[model samples]
Target: MIDKQIIDSFKNLIDGLDVDEVYKKAIVDFMDTYDGNNTNEFYSMLVAVSGLLVELKDLRIVEHGYNLIEEESEKTQDELDSIIRQFKDLNDGKLPPDPMVSTLEEDQVTD
Candidate 1:
């Protein structure tokens, strides 16, 4: 079952976002394609269009591949650290007892 607190928090986050002009400008290339309609000459127009296409391809950021990979990695690292801390608490800040030490003690008792 989903928790009510989590649902409310997420809803609040969605409600608080502001879409300003700077954000719109960042996604301008996505909203429209400029075909170099700036020039009357055909070849000159194509050169402008090609430059825009290359710029689009070279963009460092913009909803690329969903961006979930880095987020998931950070969550995984946090979980691992938590587990290690719990283990250290259980073992009194030392390594776990070795299985071989128990077997050797048993052998000495039998001999």
Candidate 2:
């Protein structure tokens, strides 16, 4: 389902990172703590993890000469901030519609 896709995307996003088992456990626990019924919480966590991945990738880029453009870093930071804001909004009970679900609905409507 769409919820699985969100979790899968988060896992894929962190595929190359060298994070500790604790961090990984925390992610799993966080995901498990929320059922798919709460799309806002699920996506908030997803975006939060994505932001963490952005920071981790930034650090890796600096550690290794990965040709990461300065503009890209800036953009990623901006995105992290936006993601944080969205998470906060979700926590505040402003449930934003899930993008994947919305797209699927649109496609079904068209069909």
Global Cα lDDT for candidate 1: 0.49
Highest lDDT: give the candidate number: 2
**Candidate 2 residue runs with Cα over 4 Å from true position:** 1-16, 63-111
* Candidate 1 regions with alpha-carbon error over 4 angstroms: 1-44, 47-63, 93-111
Q: Name the TM-score of candidate 2.
A: 0.39
Model 1 agreement with the true structure over 1-111: per-residue lDDT tens digits: 334454345334333434344533433432234343433453353345445544655553454544677788888899778667767876786655542232345567652
lDDT of 1 at 39: 33
Model 2 RMSD vs true structure: 24.9
The lDDT, on a scale of 0 to 1, for candidate 2 is 0.68
